[model samples]
Target chain A: MYGGGYIHDDQKKKPEMQAEDPVLLAEFEARIARGEKIEPRDWMPADYRRQLIRMIEQHAHSEIIGALPEGTWITRAPGFRRKLALMAKVQDEVGHAQLLYSAAETLGKSREDMINDLINGKSKYSNVFNYPAKTWADVAVIGFLIDAAAIVNQVANSKGSYGPYCRALERICYEESFHLKQGHSVFVYLATGTPTQRAMVQDALNRWWQPIMHFFGPSDKMSQHTETLMRWKVKMASNDDMRQQFLSMYVPKIWEIGLTLPDPNLKKNPETNQWEFTEPDWNEFYEVIKGNGPCNAERLAVRRASEERGAWVRAALKRADQHYVTPLA
Target chain B: MNIQSLDPRITRLGIDAEEKNPDQTLQREEHWETYQVFHQKKRGEKHSSVGVVHAPNAEMALLFAKEQYARRGETVNLWIVNTRDVLAMNYDDYDVFSTTPEKMYRDPAGYKVNDKIAAYKKAQLDV
Candidate 1:
């Protein structure tokens, strides 16, 4: 059992000497142990660099696209304060994407290339973002629960092996604190408001609950990537462990607000010191990841429309550069 | 001196010296090249660089910067400058400062204040 209190039932393999030059591997491991951040110009394994680029770029894309769902409700917010909060939250997501993309660029990928990949649908973002934010309550639930789930994962990533990613997460985590509070406040208001407001809140919670559970990824047993991720210290915690942390922290909060979680089977077990919850439909999770979610088509279409609309702005900049000339005598 | 009606003259050096080129006459339109964003969190604080945004003009740049950077209610003042207009020291000219020894005297630790503090503490105890 680890200090986090989860026993590793899986067998541990003996640490084999890396097949690469022994001296270099020793140096790499020594740096990691010393808590020294690996900068862009520093030497790293090709696989390490590739993995960081892929992960960071996808995270950036998610933030950029993730703005769309909640951005739809900014105008419809019931009060001036709510509207301002929604706008600020969406704007923060955009800023976060810029910071993340800048970090990914440290890995040698160009912003243009990553943006192209996202536009052409060659890249994947967090699957939770594909679902539509149908109502103002949905926005509240997303901020409260979806953002909360993201905060849990991001808090772990703040300790990521990549230095820039960790640094960027510092700012991101601070902003997310405000977001989580705003979300919780909105949900509380609705939960305590008129029957219609309470019903809307409940409906949003029901729709978002399963997706939140699935946000931690598939179970540890099925995660083939976990072993390598752990070996490299890229992912310090297992998927199941992160999921358990989310449930334990959040399930009670949901109940405290006088709302029921969608999973009737969910309860804390005294013996196991763990929450027993109905397993989310993994098939649906996979389906969403594969672009079969309810709002996948609509989300992609909206992104494409925005990109197309902004084409003129890019073209105008390019043309403006052509007009520059040195003053002549 | 008729300006537009002046006869074109070729200089002895064989250059077109007299003809004013219409291409040169029309001043190039200057577009907003870049914006430097500053954020002030409170009323009395100095604004600091949050980041920069590229735009077509100052007005557009300010709008974009507000939307992109200050949407979080974090800015009270913003300054936008054309990227080309900002004069910066060239790295090629940076060799002038290379001859000086590393300035250790400017560091607070270089003063060795710990000994002074200890001596003062001992005097007070003696008193």
Candidate 2:
């Protein structure tokens, strides 16, 4: 009824009419069952297209905004190698954003519209980046833990039903692995360094722990969108399942470095064969998604400023196209 | 050739002098509109045509191609060419040969090369 069509109106159709034009739902189900990738030109259910666009566009927005938090550290990196690595990593995020935006463009949304939506706060990016990067150790935590969480989600998306999105994720996942490794290397160095360095690492970890837990969203039972997404093969795993996978892979490594997670309830349960941890505060996540995060204003301002600054470049390119000519004696 | 009419920046670096007069320069720039992009997946390999990018100039063409085609790490080398320079045969002009029957002799699979090679090897062994 919200979009103008009644949900129960189809029940009034006669049985003879329904039997004549049997819905192609079975064909769509069979296509998913065969593990076939649905290309852009192929026919698909309207909801599947809507879901893919929402997920992919949000992903593109996240990559673009995610660069700002890390871009702040490029000038302050200690050594040449670290500086170069950070710069390259930030550039890669820009490149990844471009790739995803192009994929989303193929789904009927223009890049300009998507970008405008982001700047106007009509859409949302990953809530993790909305948290401030307080110290140098915060950078390492983001690269390691935040990027690690992203890798878990990306790995699942690499096998998604959409052909171009799947192909794009394959390359993105490879680059994310490098970012995770670099972050982990920095954390390991700090963890084994002086008392102050260890303390910095611990403090950063404490601030990030809650956001990392909330990264995967609420439990599967609570998510209304999860069932339809799963049935359409757009999402292969539930949010809670992916969160547990992240914990299983990361908890031991955190413990090995002799650092404590902020959550007091975090432990390995032998009976369930899973890591038991405190649930993240959903209210905070809700607030962040509603544009109430600490860095939301700053992030939007930076993006808008950059867009304004680059207007001259686009104008120059356009003008050169019309008036360009060869020189003569 | 009216060089003074164009933007001063275009003429500042003497890039315009490398070409012919104004008309020829304009013609060449117009001719250079189509660009073919080649991507080298690995070092020391021949570049292959991945796609084409269009622009008004060579520099912008290459930049556009890089953004449009080679953001991923699969490319090591890229070649951009003007589409005007490429010579292609027209299908409409080749009607005499277009409907010809399949030529099995041109295919190795149709000739049973494996059996023939096996027979040759057997002959050599006998010898």
- Residue range A83-163, candidate 1, lDDT tens digits: 888888888898888777667766776565676667666677887877877788998898888888788888887786778
| Steric clash pairs (candidate 2) | B34-B83
Q: Runs in model 2 with CA error above 4 Å?
A: A1-25, A222-225, A319-329, B1-38, B43-58, B64-76, B79-127
Residues B40-67 of candidate 1: C-alpha lDDT, one tens digit per residue? 7777998765555546666776887777
Q: Against the hidden reference, what TM-scores do the models get?
A: 0.72, 0.74
Q: Candidate 1 chain B, which ten residues in sequence have the lowest lDDT sum? A: B3-12
Runs in model 1 lying further than 4 Å from the true structure: A1-22, A222-225, A319-329, B1-127
- Clashing residue pairs in candidate 1, if any? B32-B56
Every candidate's lDDT: 0.69, 0.69
- For candidate 1 chain A, which ten residues in a row score worst on lDDT? A1-10
Tens-place lDDT per residue, model 2, A1-329, is 00000001112331321221125666666777799877665566666776677678888888888887777677777789888888778887877786676567557665666777777776677888788777778888988888888888888888878877787787688788889999898889899999999999999999989888888777757345457667667887877788889899998889998999998999889999888887789898778777788777666666665565565555555434443221100
